[model samples]
Structure formats: structure tokens, C-alpha cells
Target: MLDQAFLLYGANGYTGELIARYAAAYGLQPILAGRNKQALEQLGAELKLPVRVFALDDKIAMQQALQEVPVVVNAAGPYDFTAKQLVEACIAEGRHYLDLNGDAIIYDMIHTYDKAAKDSGVMLLPGAGYDVVPTDCLALWLKQQMPDARSLKIAFAVLNSSLSRGTAINTVLKLGLPGLSRIDGKLVEEPVGKRGMYVQFPGMKKKLFTMSLPWGDLSTAYVSTGIPNIETYINMNKAAWFFLKGQGAYNWLLKTKLVRGIANAIVKRQSPGPDKATRDKTNTLIWAQVSNENGNTLTANMVVPEAYTLTALAALLITRKVLNKEFTPGYQTPATAYGTELIMEIPGVQRGLVQ
Candidate 1:
């Protein structure tokens, strides 16, 4: 039998706490865990779930913590720094793994472990979150609408939910990095801001510029769906765009110890994020367009839940699949394993297509 699943790491972080609360609502009672026992205890108390403390740096502790948990939902961020060790432990323990990893670099690294995971009979799914789940599912849905589809273009826009400190820190770390995608079966690095365009979203038609950051969902979606030509774009407001454009300075600051200290202090002071009222009012809009060799087209709209809530929902869904033996033992995207029909069944998710 599959053992109890745990919300392994980052149970004390802002997004982690939100995911814990969502897990509680579903009566899953995930074992809250992190390096900080006090913070994990506080979060567990707030959610009324059991707490288990373990440090990712400590291999012995992590293995001990995995004793009864056959699955782990990793909410940790800057996954490029944290994913490998836990994944190694999961492989050793024969445990399934899921993570809300939005970093394309990290996803690319994990994809290499596909053969290992398959050989070990343990599934490893990254980007099981708002970053890719909704958009990935939409891609599959669009292809189904037009069976002859040969290419897909996905554009996503979120008007709400302030970026978390972990996200900001990760972005800063990745500054000046060239963004890459698999276009027409070839890897291509495209200039930043040169690929901006307007997407006619459902209920609102607006122009959204392309995000310079790379998303992991594209890699997994392509591998899973076999779509030769695919591109994923993210659109944010002018202020956010300009702020990201100025990240070159942040990257430079990270090089100096003193400057890095100051930056970390500033982030720590401002990392709490928005209040409940602000979060409850937040929403997301996604638009996808698929084109086929037969000159046919299909478009769809996806209404996503609050970003934090959606992370928990996606993770829980993946864990449930692992427990039910409904997943293949390998690295894959959520849509690849669950399919568009199952993802659309989640409440509050809206789907539409235009021909």
C-alpha cells in the first residue's frame, strides 16, 4: 500500500502555508514539514495538521522522515537549489514526488532523471502548479478540439496575486539569462521582449507582452503531447515588466556580499504578501490558440483559481493519482498524466473554445 503522503518542504513559507490550508480543507491532513520546527508547528497549528520537521541538507533526517510517506508535495522555491537532494532521497526511498517548480532550468535537469524514475517505478512530476497546470491542460484541450492540430501558441495573463519573495529572489538570480524554447523541433534562444504580442482572451481582448522568464511547462508539455511547434508566453502589467527589466542591477548586487545582505534584509521585511481580502479578490485569465496543417484553428480560455490555492489543488491531484496507481513512473507534466478532461473537472475552472 502507498504510505501517507506528506507536504515535505516549505511548510512554513507563505505559499506553503496556503497549500497546507487547502490540504486541510480536503481532509488530507498532510504532514507539515520544514527545517524550522517552530514555524512548521505554527503553520500546522493554524491548519490543525500534524507537523514533522526535517532539513533538506540532512540526508539522514530526510530519509527518516520519508519512512511512512510514499509521496511528497514539495512547495519549496528556487527549486534549482532545492530539488536535487530531495529527488535523490525520493529515488532511494522509492517514493513518488511532486513539486510546484516553475524554473525551466530545474525542470530540464529533472527531465534527465526520467529513465531513473521509470526504472525505479517512482513518478516525478514538476511544475504541478498554476505556473503550468492550467495552460498545459488548455493545450491538450485545444488539440482535442482540432484533431489535426500541428502547432500551438499559449498566452497567459494574471491580473492578481502579488509575486512572492521566493519568486522575486529566483527571478533576480536568473537575470540576464537567455530564454529558450523548443520551436519546430529545435531549441532556440529568443531575444527578450522581441516576441511580445496581443492575445484575444475570453471576456477581454488585450495586448500582452511576452515574459522573458522561461517556464518549465513548455518542456514537459511538448514531451507529453508531441506537439512539434509550441510556445508559452506570460503577460504582466507595465510596472511589473519595467521592474523585471531593471533586474540587471539586482543581479549585480547579488555578487557583492554586503549588497546581497541588504537585498535579503529588504526582501525579508517585505515578504509577507497581500492580505486575505486582497487574495480572495485575485483572479487569472489564460488564452490558448492551436493551428493545424489543415488551416483549422481552435482557441480556449481558462479561468484559474488563486495562485496559491491552485498550487495545493494541483499537488493534491498528483498525490491522489500516485496513491491510486493512475500515473506512469516517470517525469511528466500534470496534463500529460491526468489529461484535459480530468483537469477541467476541478471546480471554478472555466473552459471555452473558438473555431
Candidate 2:
């Protein structure tokens, strides 16, 4: 049997560090692992946790690194390259997998391996972070309130001073990719900036323009609520959309390995993430509306602290639940395994339906 320990993979990254800090405070002695030995050593020194160093491609080494930890809280991003491998390794090692990844591709991959995870008696819980945790819970809650709903719309507003290097790089990679929506229970791909609209919030005088994107909930919500029509949007201004809309045009260039390498190189020199004070001042809001075929509708809004901060808190809480044996095997969403009120457990999160 695997030991009852959490493994903080990619513990050297900015988000990983945030999770490690909270995991430590929560009295979790997580084994910090990543490719950067020096960085891992530094973080381990501060957190006083053991460190594991191995590249993502080293399958044997990766499996060995995970042997002692029954739960893996992956905080790495641009997870297109990492999530699959980590999931495979976890299943093999009989370790429950969790991550803050918001990528739609990872969700698609999870769908395929869910059965494998079940057979291994391990759980694969992705998007435990800000990407789909709160949004998924809200979607499930709305479904309970209006079980007849056939359509759903979710919008996000993230207020932060700057993006972490991992986040910025993920943005660069995701820019040119086409968007997606769930229509009539089918995953449908749309143009890069399709369905752009200015959405209003509960107490905001100013409306924010949001472009359709393949958020994690696009996959998780259907499993959680059985909603047939789903659409997700990220808050963006005209200036930001201008650049976002242009991605498809130059996607041919941006998609090339050479260009992506350069982009990653440029990101490497920049700061990892916001400072502690900036993070303390940051916040996020999520608004969701669900409507039935008969025109009955329900709307709810949620507010939480900074995206990164929320991820840290959510990760720890979820991890604690897993450790205490409040767990479910196979691919799971936080809302599905926990409940519609899971988001409410967070410190600053508040949710209320619009009357």
C-alpha cells in the first residue's frame, strides 16, 4: 500500500510554491518534486519538505518519485505536456491525482482513462483549482435548483496585477487554439473568438466583454449536471480581444516550435508571479446563469480571493478530504466528489442566486 503522504509535484513553480506554503501550514508534509534541483532545494529549505527531482519524460524515475505519496497535487501548467504523464504514472502507482490545470485537452484525456483509474483503484481529480472548482460547484448547484435547465452560461472575471510565468506561457500557447462549447450534449469546436459579448455582473455598472474559451467546466459540468448546452467566457477588454482575435491569423507562425520556444524563453526571464502583497489584494468573481427550455432561469454569483490564493486553499482542503478517506475513485470533479456547496467552504467565497 502507498504511504499516506501528498506529493507536491512542480513545487518550484510559483503556483506550486503557493500550494506548498499552505500545505505546510495545514501540517501536510508534502514531498516537493520538480525538474529544477536548485529551485526545489530552495523551496524545500523554506518549507522543510523533502524534494524529488525528475524530468517529466522519465517514466521510471517519475513512478519511483511517486511511490511514497498516495496523493499528487500537481500545480504545473501548460499541462498539455504534463497532465497525461502524471495521470498515467499515478494510475500505475495507485496514487490519486489532482491538479489546478484548466486546459480542455487534459479533460478530454481524462475521459479516456477514467476506466483505467477506476480499475487501479485510484482517483483522477483534475481542475481542483480556480479553473473549474468553483464554477463546477455552481453549475451543479444551479442544476439542483432548476433540474429542468437545458442551457448554461458561465463567465469569469479575474482581477490580478500580473500573470505568473506559467500562466503567461499557458496564455501564449492557448491563444491561437480554437474555442469550444457543449451543444446538445456534444463537444463542439468553434472559431477562436466566437460568441464574444459584453456580460454584466450583479453589482457592476460596467459590463465586461468575454470571448468564448474551452474552460474545464465545458467538460466537467456535463458530468456533474447533465446540462446539454454549455458555454464559457473569460472577461476581456476590447484591447485584449483585439489581440486574442488576431491569434488565429498568425497561428500558423505561433504554432511553430521555433516561435513557441522563443516565447517560452522570453517568459523564463520574467517574474514568476505577483508578490505576496499583490496576491493579498487580488480577487476573482464568477457569474453563472442557467435556463430551462420553458424560459425559467436561475443566476448565481461567486466571489473569492486571488485565483492563485484560491487554488492553494482549494487544493489543501481537497487533499485533506482525500487523506481522511472522504474520497471517490475514477475521474472526479470537486463538485461531483464533494458537493455543490464545496466552494462555500473557502474563506472569502460567497454565492447567492439573482432574484
Candidate 3:
């Protein structure tokens, strides 16, 4: 029964702005919000949408903000600090929740809210963006193909080299942390970037050096496909790999509160994100290969719009679904709640290109 308009918290962030404009084009007047008064005002002025400026930690402000919108889409990253507060507020206010977060730790922690969310009669769906939408849908499709699959591996070959400031923070939040894998149906942490391989993305001719990275799939894929022993990789050059590996050695530095503060400050000062030309020109190719103990393999890939564009599309798509009379409350995985064809609904999403 939550029928108010959307509250797009963190609406001035890179992906948040894209979602805001896309929603406007869809005839939605979402309330723009975030901690920065200047950025919020700037975005509100351009979009002509109402702005609500408030810090995440202000419970009264957050609660009042939630009451103004039936659903809230969080575009903030390093969601470690933001997601919990907003989600809790949504539950308290009887508002639905969605976000662009892909941190496995956050995803795992959020799963604990399932019963509370269901009791509140509102959905609390994360991984609603490029972080897990495309990949999660693909995992379920592979499961449909090979129901007996025992292991799964997903590789991300983001044809775009430009990492948005938002994504950089998401990456930095877990930097130096061990990679995660679901082994025999339980989440396990292993040294990330410990090994490497060459993976030829389906749409590409040449192979790229793919290194292990802890992605959201470490948790969501299991809920979607029940495939144990999963590993997600990202295409990276030697220099990127070197920096990633070096994190393990210098993790001591990353653990310091001062270093965390400095990193967050650096990210805040970064440009909002790539330009329109950059988003249009770049494609994100994600490949997933699933196999059973019998050696039968089901492999495929998806060629989608740039990560930010896809995030906007996915956000809109989910918002529409959440607005329907028939809603599935509680914590939900992308594919588990919507099925494998979810990404197909997005504009410019190409799928099933096998290697």
C-alpha cells in the first residue's frame, strides 16, 4: 500500500543522476536526496525535482525522508555505512527499499533483515543494479540449462576502462580483503588475486588476463542457482593486478582509520562519472560458465550498455515491478525474484553469446 513517489537517496552521485533523469523521462518525480547540500541542490535544480538534504546518520531526518516516498533507491556506495541505515528506516517507515550496492559483506549482512522486511509488507531488494542484475540473471539461466551444475564461474570484461568514482569506492571498500567463494554451499573467503587465467569474452576476439575478485555473486548466485563453488573474476592488466596483490601486503595500511578516511575523501573529490559519449561508446561484457561433475558445461555471455546506463535501466525496471499490486517482500536476489530474462527487458542487452 505504499503509494508515494520515489525518494532517490544519494541522487547526486554518478549513477544516481542517471537514474534520476531516466525516471523523469518515465514521468516519475522522485525526491532527490543525499548528504551534500550543494550537489543535491544542483541536481534538483537541473531535474526540477524536489530536494531533501540530510546525512545518513540522522534518524529523524531519514525517517521523515522515507515517509515522503513509497520506495527508495540508494545509489550510494561503500554501502557499508549507508545501506543499513536507509534499509532500517524503510522498514520502520513501511517503505520499499532498493539499492545499487554489490558488496558481498553488505549483501550478507542485509540478508538478516528478510523476516523484518517481510513483516513490514515491503520489499528490500539490493543488487538491483549492474553489480548483480545481469550476472545474477545469467546464473539462473545457466542453472535452467544445467540443473545439476556443481560449480560456477563468472568473469567480467568491462570493455570500459573508466571506473566511475562510485564504483572505485565500491572496489576500495573491500580492497585487500580475501576473495569470496561459496564452497559446498557456504560462503568462504580465500586470498583474492591469488591466481589468474586468460578468458576470452564471447563478443571479443582476444583473451584478457582475468583475475579473481570478490564480487556480489559470492552470495547472490547461491541463492539464485544453488551452485556451489563459485568464483567471479574481472579483466585487469598486469598493473591492475599488481596493485590488487600489493593490497594484501599493505593491508596493514588499508586497515587504518586514517587511510580509510583519506581514501573516502579522495573518492568524494573525483568527477561524478564518465560523459554521455563515454557511456554510449563503452559496452560491458559479462561471461558465465557453469558445469556439472560429469563435465558437461553451459557457457554464455551478455553484452549490455555501460554499467551506469544498465544500472539506471535496472533500477527503473525494478521500480515498476515493485509498484505492482503483487509484490514479493523480504530480501530477494535479482534472478530469484525476477527470473533469468530480467536483463532481457533492459534496452540494448544482448545475451547468450557463447565462447
Candidate 4:
């Protein structure tokens, strides 16, 4: 049996630190666990919590560290490299697993372990972050409002400052990669930046162009709402899109061994963006428009904080639910596991249907 409160893996990373602070504010005495002993110690001292050191590569150490913890929040990102090991450890220990994974590949990989997790009765929920939570939860809410909806479209727009090193590295690696999403009950390859449309968002009534992307929430929502056709769009400025278009040279660089060197240089030289002023000025908009056979449409809006913080909060909230056995074992999304009613209960969130 696991103890009531256990650990937060990767508690030393940039986003991990934010999660630690948020967890502390929530009155959770989570054991800070990560590879860097010094960084973990520094964070623990700051948060006034005990520190535990365990590298993800050391399976024995990870298992031993998690033995007494009933739940573990994997705040680590670029989860492609870390999710599997942590999930395996949690399964072996019957501990609940939660991650703020936005990588679709990682989500698909975790979904493969659904049967194993179910058999062991360990809850596993990935993408408990801003990427999927707000959008997926909104989709669930929209479906409930329009039970006859057969097809749906989600457009997500975030106005914020510069990108983080981890985000940049991940994006560079995934550039030009094909995306997959279920369309009309078939798995289809989504063309990067191929689809675009203008849609109105709350507060800002102007229509903005949105492009199709592979968001894990769509897959989770398909199962949750049984909606036949689903599509997700990300709204960004034309300048960003043009910048993304100019990344051919960067992609070539990533294909070589110099990627790590280049990434390190960029991180050292670049300043962290979306500063306090930028974050306060920024806002996230999620629009889910559902249409039925009769052509009736319903739209809803959601406000999200800076991407990383929202993801951390959503993951933390899901971790709490897993601890209380409020969710089921096996692969699921926050909206699917917690339900829209519970998801909307989180503070700083609002829900409404567009007339």
C-alpha cells in the first residue's frame, strides 16, 4: 500500500519548480524527487519539503523512492524521453501516474499500456495539461449541451510571449513530422499547417486563422463523447507561422549531432519569455463549435493561463483525484476521467454557450 502523499518527479526543472510551488500552496507536502541532488535540495529548502533523489534511468531507485507514495505527479516535459520509465515504475508499485505530456507520440505510447494499467488497477492519465484539459473539457461540455452533435471543431488560441528552451527543442525535433488523428472512425494523417479558417473568440470578436494540429485530447474526447468527426486548430499570428515556415535550416541542424550543442547555445543566449507583464497581458482562448445533422451550431469559450502553469495545475488537480480513487484505472484524459462538471469546478475557469 502507498502512503497518502509521495513525490513529484523532475521537481528541479523550470516547469517542475512551478508545480512544486503550486503544490506547496495547496498544502501538499510532496517529496521533491529528481536527478540533480543540489537543485532538488534548493527547491526543497525553498518549499520547506523533504527532498528525495532518484534518476529516471535507475529503475530500482525510482521504485524504492515511490514505494510508499500513493500518487506521483510527473511534471517532467518532453515526456517522450521520461514518461515510459516513470509509468512502468508506478505500475509495479500500484501508484497512480499523472503527467503534463503534450507530445502526441508520448500519449500514444502511454495509451499502449492501458491494459497493463487496468489489470494492475493503477490509474494512468496523460496530457493532464493545458494542451488537452481545457480543450477536451470544453468539448465534453459542448457535447452535453448538444447531444445530437455528430461532428465538432475546436480552435485554440494563446496570446503570450516567447517560447521556452524545452518547448523550442521539442518543436524543432517534431518539425515536419506527420500528425495523426481520428476522422470519421479512421486514423488519418494531418497535414501540418494545411488547414486554416477564421473563427470568432470570446472577448475578441475578430476572426482569426487557425491551423490543424494533432492534439491528444481529440483522441480522448472521441472515446468520451463518441463524436464521429473531430478536428483541432491552433490560432497564431502570421509572423509565427512564417517563422515556422523558415525552420528548414533548423530542421537540417536537428538531423545532425550538433542539435544538442545548438540547443544549449540558444538556451544560454535567450532570455525566458512571457514575463510577468507578458503573462498578465496574455490570454488563452478555446472555441469548440459542434454541429449536428440538422446544422445547428453551439460554441463555447475557455480561458487558460500561461501554457506551463495551466498544465501544471491541471496535472496537480488530476493527481489529487487519483489519490482519492475518484478516477478509473487505465489510459484516459482529464475530461474523460473527471467529467466536465468536475473539470469546470477548477477556479479561474468559466463556461458558456455562444448564442
Q: Which candidate is the best by TM-score?
A: 2
User: For candidate 1, what's the RMSD?
Assistant: 2.9
lDDT per residue, candidate 1, 264-285, as tens digits?
6777777565567776786677
**What's the TM for model 2?**
0.94
Write one digit per residue (lDDT tens) for candidate 3, span 1-355: 2353688988888888898989955556678899989988988898788999999878889888887778899987769888999888899999889998887788988899999999999888899999899999999999998899999999998875477887877766665456777789888878777668888786677888999888888889988888988888998896878777667678878767788778879987888688889899989988899999999888888888898888898988888777664468898888878889889998888887474
**Model 1 residue 346 CA deviation in Å:** 2.1
Cα TM-score of candidate 4: 0.89
* Candidate 2 global CA lDDT score: 0.86
Worst 10 residues of 2 by lDDT: 1-10
- RMSD each, Å: 2.9, 1.9, 2.1, 2.7
Tell me how far the alpha carbon of residue 48 in candidate 1 is from the true structure, in angstroms, after superposition.
3.6
Candidate 2 residue 132 Cα shift, in angstroms, is: 1.0
Give the alpha carbon lDDT tens digit for every residue of 144-207 in model 4.
Answer: 9899999888888876556665666666566556656667855577555556678787778688
Error of 3 at 180 (Å): 1.6
Best by lDDT: 2
For all predicted structures, in order, the TM-scores are: 0.88, 0.94, 0.93, 0.89
Candidate models: Cα lDDT each: 0.73, 0.86, 0.84, 0.75
Ranked candidates, highest TM-score first: 2, 3, 4, 1
Give candidate 4 regions above 4 Å deviation. Answer: 1-4, 239-264
Error of 4 at 179 (Å): 3.1
Q: Which ten residues in a row have the lowest lDDT in candidate 4?
A: 246-255
Positional deviation of residue 310's Cα in model 1 after best superposition, in angstroms: 1.2
